[model samples]
Target: MTSIEETAPGRDHFTDFDLDSPEFTEDYEQVLGDLVAKCPVAHSKVAGGYYVVSRYDDVRQCAQDWETFSSEGGFEPGRGGEGGAKLYPVELDPPYQTRWRNALGPYFSPRAIRSREANIREQVNYLIDGFIEKGRVDFVEEFAAHLPGRVFFGSFLGVPFSELPPIQKATDDAMRGPMEGRGEAWVAVATFLDGYLRARQEEPPRDDFIDVILAGVEDHDGNPCSWDHKLYVLTDLLAGGIGTTTYLLAGIAHHLATHPEDRAALAEDRSLWSGAIEEFIRYYASIVALGRTATRPTEVAGQSIAEGDFLMLSFAAACRDPKYFENPHEIDIRRKIAVNPAFSFGPHRCIGSHIARLEATISLEEILRRLPDLALAEGGEPVYSNSTIARNMDSLVVTFTPGEREGRTE
Candidate 1:
């Protein structure tokens, strides 16, 4: 295995563009477009020793071929070691990874998620009720950010609303990348889940997700998945599901507020919900990139990459690549859409994709119904997250007409 230092001589890739820069976040589409056009497989010295794959075909292939590009180590540079362990099945390769994934798959299936719809809708309405009367609210914190964490935890673990705050805090910290005191936060969350899992194991089964995972039997590397493994998997699910969905929700709200015509068109026909969500995902590409390590020395698109070299597959760039979709830069809800790498492609595709769609679709439909004339607050600018793994807005303020019914009493 090539060390991080020896992988590239003399420089790091991705120095010119600051992944966290406000300018990049503001003009992300334009910047990525230029890069794809100029150098689809560009190498940057600033990003340590990694190469960026921006074209649609390249990214799709990188995601599909687990043999050539392994996900075992952390996808991004410097994250593969200890930091990557928290990702669970996502950070593991096939065969071994498949066991854990298959074990948890039934819990997030379409039918299972549908069973929770009434509860989800009630929760959404509750959150919206708290803010709808105000006419103006920060959609991220007051609404979007709160919904997913609560719903996922409530439905999966059968936890009470009181536990959401600390869970949300830990998940948010994890999404922001490694931080001081995060170890303690992870421990606290893990400890709580361990107790919960042990309790569930002893009791008669409930229909919730925790019951499903615990009741099912699976072996990882000759050993049964202990409570620790279950806790880690839950942590990964909470972090991955909540943060990305929140970002996409904020993105949709931001776009709709600015482009009333699109919102109006959708309002006229609620059947367009599915397509509208797809268009939103393609337009925003919230989770910017997926990380991979070259399992063996591989040559892609005429560029030679050595074994163990870090690679960043730019999903944001690929989704908008004109090679795949015409007028890729423009957002058109009417466009005939197909499978997008937005939820990723191949084996490691998002397990919670169905749930995410249900959440986003329900949230959008309800928001439009309650406040049809929503618009961004005057001079409001979105605050975005900085991590390379996930792209998200921190906050979005909006103004809309009040609903007849109040949402949450608190």
Candidate 2:
């Protein structure tokens, strides 16, 4: 995409629009609305040749045709053309993908997630209690950034607390795209996983996710998936499970802070939270966009797409399509329950969607219960990390009247 410091000629063309442009973070709805209205299948020059599908129907069509729009065309920052760290099932297709899904999806299934609620509640409450008395807190670092990973990665996946920090850093750094020493950082992570597996190999089988995975989660061939494959699975699980929730929670918190009317309604009517959470997820989709490569000559939204060409599905944009959503810009908690693209679509729809919903629901209920008076913490401002793939707030400072905890037992 083209950019100019001053208003230069030909800036009105869709080619001048860029997902990575800083303006997108500020007003994507406005920008993407224009794209959908004018160029639903607009071409972008950034990150090699790509066509961005902005309309809901078009994006949905691409997602449905995974055969034509393969997810195997990776999105890693470096490693030659491939996206960083293989994402297992998300990076696989069909029967093989089904194997990866079976091995992992059950863990986050709604029934399985119920087993985690007590701990999730305890963990979330404990984190809030840490700063509840202080009346102010950095929600991102102190909570959002730490909680989901701690639950899914640290607690569920059985990574020792002592070893989580470095690996978490490595995964994050590597995802922020190609940078100096990303390979080294990735290697460090792989080395840690290797050692972790080796240590597990010596011990008796345990019930932990790691132990079960190590004991032998079979591939499509009915043989155990290789350690390398396992490493990517672990990496994908950790990476996918953490920041997505972090950003979503952060976005919700931001919404509550900025839109106090909606916040008040949610607070007053607890039953509204479940649907409201979904609405919030739609309104402020943090996993903004994902890519698929055309496997062969394909057509979408009347635009001819060549094989091997990249097509970016703008989920945030799709969620706001006026065709599907009335008063699209306005946040309505009671919007009729139809398909939402916040978790994506088709076979690759978010595996942890149920877990994420439960977590967000519980979190919403608890935070509102405890901090009924919570608001923007003094003069604090929210910060965000904007990228084409995802744009999440970096931090959100919020305040509430110092309150007592429920002191529930574990």
Candidate 3:
């Protein structure tokens, strides 16, 4: 599809940029390309009134300036927290954000990550075993979703496997599901977490995240973290940890199936996997956009904004900015990226970044070694949802060289 600039004649400001429309989202590179070139800072009327900052410097500025752009506001304009639940650490700034980060950060500390590595490696191989001999499988359903579902739900979060389906469905819907159904989707997520968190609060077994937080994690005031805040943070982990990684792994599979040369190069040299994963993240940034409500009147990228306005920091777009990257569109695994804002920027950056990279890197190394010739499955169409929030593939059907699994024994 031609860019809005070329076809729209004298139309300077773009209103055709709808994140929820696949027509716009499926072709995100081209869409963001146009925005970066023609409109660094543009307004969208989609979710009421908001500005999208598409440039690298501008987005970094907005993300770094927590006082000006507050994550505390619910995604949309005019919306705030639910009851007393702030959006956990991401939604908070300064002393509160610091308190929560310090308290829960230990859960994913280096020692914790090293402990999980063995299981993560085992799980990757186990999931591959299910489809390695079959020669074809929906990578998303059988592998991408299952790997994280097991890792995040069963291992990390300690959520009952029985409850995963509804929780996963609710989060997926709330982030990228239909517009009319969004309220229900969000409500479903909160309801499940509310019950689960409330139960954990009473029990205080300290076995998992909820137990730890409920048992003793304190707020800025050194008081026990509020129940509502705990729920929000738990939701953040469930939603963020599961959703982002699922799509990214599927995206790596999609890229490998389509690009034979890069796949061959990586398979030929195991060392390339580390650097390649970084490039892959830069290419397919999963968290499409994060919201911030302007606390005071401010200008981004030389564009003026009012105090009450909301802003969208497009990390996906920022990663694609040519000013920061040499060949912004092309995927060059060998390229040494000075920096990529895929995990976001500043204090609000994702906390689970180390574990996420470990998951992707290990999964890729094993999958490539075991299923060397996997190709996009014939007669099946893959799906990527077009949404304002998350960018994830729904399905990735793939066929591989058969009997590769039989050659190796666990």
lDDT of 2 by residue, 210-301 (tens): 66567556666777777777777766666676678888887777777777888788878878887888887787777767888888997888
**How well does model 2 score by local distance difference test?**
0.73
lDDT of 1 by residue, 1-410 (tens): 22224322222223444455555666676667765665667665545757788888888899899888888767566677653245666777787678777877887888878988888888888888887778998998887777887787776667777667777676556555356876776676677667777888889877666764675345446666665556667667776787788888888888888899999988899878788898888887877777889989888777898998877888888888887778988988887678877888878888988888888888888888887898999867788765666687887989998766654454
- Order the candidates by TM-score, highest first — what do you get? 1, 3, 2
Provide the lDDT at 299 for model 1.
83
lDDT of 1 at 312: 82
Q: Candidate 2 has what TM-score?
A: 0.87
TM-score of 1: 0.89
Error in Å for residue 126 of model 2: 1.9
Global lDDT of model 1: 0.76
TM-score of each: 0.89, 0.87, 0.87
How far residue 195's Cα lies from its native spot in candidate 2, in Å, is 3.7
Worst 10 residues of 1 by lDDT: 1-10
Per-prediction CA RMSD (Å):
4.9, 3.9, 3.6
